[model samples]
Target chain A: MEQSGDRVTLGLDEVFAIAKSVLVAAGLPERQAEPVARVITEGQRDECHSHGLFRLPGCVQTINHPRFNRAAVPVVENTTPAVTKVDAGFGYSLPALEAAMPLFVEKARTVGISVLAINNCFHFSALWPEIEMLTAKGLVAIAMTPSHSWVAPAGGSRGALGTNPIAFGWPRAGQDPYVFDFATSAIARGDISLHKMAGKPLQPGWAIDADGNPTTDAAAALDGAMLTFGGHKGSALSTMIELLAGPLIADMTSLESMDFDDGVKAAPAHGEILIAFDPAILGGGVRDNQASSERLFSAIVDQGARLPSVRRYEARARSLAHGVQIPRHLYDQVMSLPRAG
Target chain B: MEQSGDRVTLGLDEVFAIAKSVLVAAGLPERQAEPVARVITEGQRDECHSHGLFRLPGCVQTINHPRFNRAAVPVVENTTPAVTKVDAGFGYSLPALEAAMPLFVEKARTVGISVLAINNCFHFSALWPEIEMLTAKGLVAIAMTPSHSWVAPAGGSRGALGTNPIAFGWPRAGQDPYVFDFATSAIARGDISLHKMAGKPLQPGWAIDADGNPTTDAAAALDGAMLTFGGHKGSALSTMIELLAGPLIADMTSLESMDFDDGVKAAPAHGEILIAFDPAILGGGVRDNQASSERLFSAIVDQGARLPSVRRYEARARSLAHGVQIPRHLYDQVMSLPRAG
Candidate 1:
């Protein structure tokens, strides 16, 4: 272990082991604990600290619910030639999505495209893993999910939208997939919290004061609301995600999500949409796609612009090599938890 | 006709009829001219003058090509139980999309979801019509397509991305569907051209100087490149659209489109994607969806934020009742064309 300032560096294996033990201790059944732990571990591996172990304690709170279905299994309610609906039993999103992608791949290869609609899931993890997984399997995947409303509309004063995020993945044959995941909010709520903690002034357009006037004060913005990523366009994206994940999938809207809550906070139980495409049918087959994709990435990187997936993909390699640095307080809190029975 | 300063207002039917005559006179087949004309007239009705008759002469230049196929028809292939592909035969997008939406809607209603991948078409119209069509049939639809690269990616100077656009539509049983269409660029490139012509200063974040520094001088910005909406997040969306509508669909990318020219210039040859969702399978069926969708729209409208589709819908109604205005010079040019023999 290496300690520097307020940060502690630990090996990938150690992080995974700790996460798994903590999840089990948090009362997740072993079968469920491993996959969820792996999702958190991968976030840490990818250096997405926001979605990594920092989010695990909240996951535990939802899991600790008396009504939480420990042995819940995803149910396939309807299967057509091209689309499938998976009822995720109101559990975490990763496992359900993991179970659904193979079916989408098979359908897409045969028909050139497929859609897997997943409902009633707590989607707390980073979106890259599912998309990256499909891209590795030689497919193009697009995913969208909603969260509880925490953003105001472009001209409005109230929080009426989730940070609602969208993700996309494109395959490059023998290389890492081109992928990106982003929240439609100008700034994330967690980021605002961090800015407040550090007493840092925020950039313009990041948030608004209680009166709906734009503000540079982090604490004031925290008490008000986050702005959409690109003004009205970001607000539109968030609205679209909410509809696709809510009424379109027969799931709860952010406004409606509060009605179902019993005070145990976790990722909102939202629906999600994932569409996959077969490379052979669309991209002139694997070889041609690989060539074009590589050229595209080269153009981006040569211009000194980072491809969305490259940074995380490279971070994964570094984590396995030199390990990840975690804030000592965050690490200490997890380590202090009792071991599983 | 009512005169309004430099423009004249004509009935919507008259606008459509004149447009149809002009397109036919420009060498489009009668079979194809009406749809294309209707698309243009709708733009005028919506007060979207940029895409209205102002764009028709360019459409004519392309349609008048010696190699232009007046009988061009979309070919559907690679159909599976779940997905279908449409090759647009290098024609305009409106007719091809008009042919494909029915099949997608039927497939989605039966299978829970379906995707229509369209290639080899010139897409220059608003995306709402197609999405509105599917949503009217009680389906959720999302559409994406790419265009000429005129926007710079984040952290880079040269233009490497299109103002790639995305459109989404959600059903509302007794009311108009909620729909939206937007360019990925911070401001439409055409808007910049108009600003230049009007001697107007550009808005901040709208564009950059050739050296990539943000600038408010419209002329300098025009000499440079447009900025992507929301910075890095917008770049990611543009990249995703490129992959989906280009390599993933065996189609020409913006860069590649620029390479293929037979003298005549118009909308670039590109591909598009549209995915439709069956509300019944996910949203607890029809009545539940209608109620929830209406509530969602109510919340948006009640908060004083405009719903994307409502304005367009009302515009269509007003155009039908009170007519639309056309600039005299543009109207004169179209009227001067000889009717098709």
Candidate 2:
């Protein structure tokens, strides 16, 4: 691994090996470590930094906790042609989500739609990758997940909600799929951490201190609650996700017992709900749908329209063409970590 | 009708009478006037000021136009257990949406989900009422509609997208259905008009002038485009709606030529798409689903959780108990319109 600033450049193989080794060092079984490692590394490859290598440390710590039943497998207690429920058995979200994807895709093919509600799963990495996978198969996919407390209610002071994230993906014709992944929070926790690391103040109105006073100090904001993205609207979206992902899926009333540090304890287990729609089931099949999408998008762009994800796609392509440029410090931090044999 | 200041206090019956009579006088057959009147009146009752009585004069003018095809009716061209497509035959959206709802509900009851896409319709009124009707039947509903030029692309200037709105409704146990309805614009067109009426400057960053420079002047903002809420994320959402409601429903793309002033000549043959889902089809049946949702919302609230639509619901209740509080000036404007019969 070569150290840049806060980023490290490693061959994909090497990155996976190191991640697996780290998980093993943290007491995960060798058998389970590889899959977890692969999932995380793939996230980095896809440029989902928040859920990529940056989350390895957290995952390792959670896996090492005796409360987390890493050896347990997901159990499907109920299923239908279009819906399924997976009990994660206190295992990480990666395995459960991985197990559900194929089932979801299969069901969608038959019924034109499918839903998978995963209960008792750990933090799944960036949801967009999973959405991307579904969209690549010409299906429209929406994934929602809730977190431990990080967001405040509309006008209240205490952090009572998570920065619940929702993602949607749509397949396009002759262009990159339109993928939208966003947190309901004004800014991501990773961005807050970064600002803190850089000794920079947060923008005003992004967060509130414990006393409910808005503040721009990154450290204080960290100790407080992140504001919702679009005020009450974003907060409402987060609340909706919590109801759908946490309570509805896990059969819990609220996330009161979900402590940020209890990555091991499964009380008030985090959940995820995914809904998939197959375009072929509609009036036209996938090809026809694609053509329609193409025509509309072309007309808009021809009429001086700009698509939201176009810039990100362009940036990603450029980064891929010239090796991902990582900051020296971040690179050094990753490189300095002990490597597995 | 009594004019109070610039406001008017017309009983619900009188308001309906005026609207129905105007549409009839404008050449719509008496039979079609009732549904159109019901839709507009419901908007006022629901506290959606902009889409309600405020739109009466404009709609009347459209109805009077010779090209409007006032007597056209929608035709259902496709049907499945859970999907339907209706060709509106170049009519108004109100009748088409009203006609599609019961069908959508019936299909969802059979298959646990249904999607109705209507093409060649005009701009529909407030979406929440339609969602409210669906949720009352113990189903989740999502509605999307595409409108004329109002919103700009993420980074570029010029209006290329509509203030496409997406509304979602979740049926809760014993609670008023959770409804989220908002335009994707940072500031809705109604807000801009209100600002102009009040002779107030809009908040900076909410809109851009025709040349694409950010401005707070209401007139400039009116000539310019509204920024998408939450920047790129909101823009992505708006684009998704356009795809789903516009071309997916086989309606004209916003980039196509159309006249905005004359709904008959400039109308883009817009449409509405609705998706209804039954909770019983998932792992748990409807009862369990409702119970789970109840528990989740309670837990979040126990921890000071505040949801996005909670206040709106409260406001609605108050409005119901007392009556909708319309601004005096707006009331006067409505009452001052030339009466028919």
For TM-score, the strongest prediction is: 1
Model 1 per-residue lDDT tens digits across residues B56-79: 777777786554566788787646
lDDT of 2 by residue, B202-278 (tens): 99768999998898999999888888787777777787777777655455445431443343543345678888877
The C-alpha lDDT values of all candidates are: 0.78, 0.70
DockQ of predictions, in order shown:
0.60, 0.30
Can you tell me the DockQ of model 1? 0.60
Q: TM-score for all predictions? A: 0.94, 0.86
Kindly provide the TM-score of model 2 when superposed on the true structure, using C-alpha atoms.
0.86
Interface RMSD per candidate: 2.5, 4.4
For model 2 the local lDDT of residue B148 reads 70
Classify candidate 2 by CAPRI docking class. acceptable
- iRMSD (Å), candidate 1: 2.5
